[model samples]
Target: MVKEGLLDILKGNFLVSDEASKNWRFLLFASVLAALMIASSHQADKKVHHIADLTQQVKTLKSTQVKHKREIQQLLLESRLKEELAPIGLGVPEQPPAKIQIVSQP
Candidate 1:
């Protein structure tokens, strides 16, 4: 009888009409598998949402950076132009840029 029961379990033939109280092992196994599938699906969906949100934020920051960089460059050009026109007293000369000279010692 015990060998037959063991073989039944090994064969995994837990039919729904089984009125046997000892048939809960198959139910528990199925329940755990179902729960695992649900949790993994939810986790994957969350990761996808997070990635999309991060991508949008990165795009926004990149556009903001580009705008600020363009404004800074325009300001620098205007200042240099004013300096060049300062000889006729339209503006004061701007300070010179820092220099790096590579000197060779023989």
Candidate 2:
């Protein structure tokens, strides 16, 4: 009997047998689970790729920020300021600034 059952399974006859109706619900549930697992796997892959792309963008933005910071620091130097202002005839004062004292009459 066991050999016959195994033979029937191997020959795919069990799928058409009367007992097959009893397993339809379980088969449908398993198929749904398999499809959900595939969809979840694809969603996970998309998130991973998105994270990688964002990481690359962050690296690029960081490098650009560093470049701009360096340029700003260079421009803030007194020598660079003097060079930039030379064309406009602006220069450091040669004499000290004077402060005037006012006397209040009582």
Candidate 3:
């Protein structure tokens, strides 16, 4: 199998080992290393995906913040305009716009 060949290539120490348990030791070591590599790669992919999703969320929040700021500015402008028109009675209503009062002379 491909796994066995790669495992043999990685276990260079096994070729020089004189002990009968050398094969078991080398295979176990190689298997552990390969597992670690696989786990690290999977973790790295998850981290990258999380970062990308966070970036998109940040962009969306930034856009929403800008829109809220614009709305606040517009409301402020409207309030100031209303204040300026208050003396001449152009916008706000102490009375209706079409209503007028006349005085009677004796």
Shift of residue 68 alpha carbon in model 3, Å: 0.5
lDDT of 2 at 99: 89
Give me the displacement of residue 11 in model 1, in angstroms.
22
Quick one: best TM-score, which candidate? 2
TM-score of each: 0.58, 0.84, 0.58
What is the lDDT, from 0 to 100, of the residue 52 in candidate 1?
100
TM-score, cand. 1 vs. native: 0.58
lDDT of 3 by residue, 1-106 (tens): 9888688669865566576387778778999999999999999999999999999999999999999999888767978889877798788667667866898998
Compared with the true structure, what per-residue lDDT tens digits does model 2 show for residues 1-106? 9999799879988678788876677789899999999999999999999999999999999999999999999999999999999999997889988889999999
Better of 1 and 3 by lDDT: 3
For candidate 3, the per-residue lDDT at 11 reads: 81
Tell me the spans in candidate 1 whose CA falls farther than 4 Å from its real position.
Answer: 1-22, 78-106
lDDT of each: 0.83, 0.93, 0.85
Query: Against the true structure, what is every candidate's RMSD?
Result: 9.4, 2.3, 11.3
Error of 1 at 68 (Å): 0.6
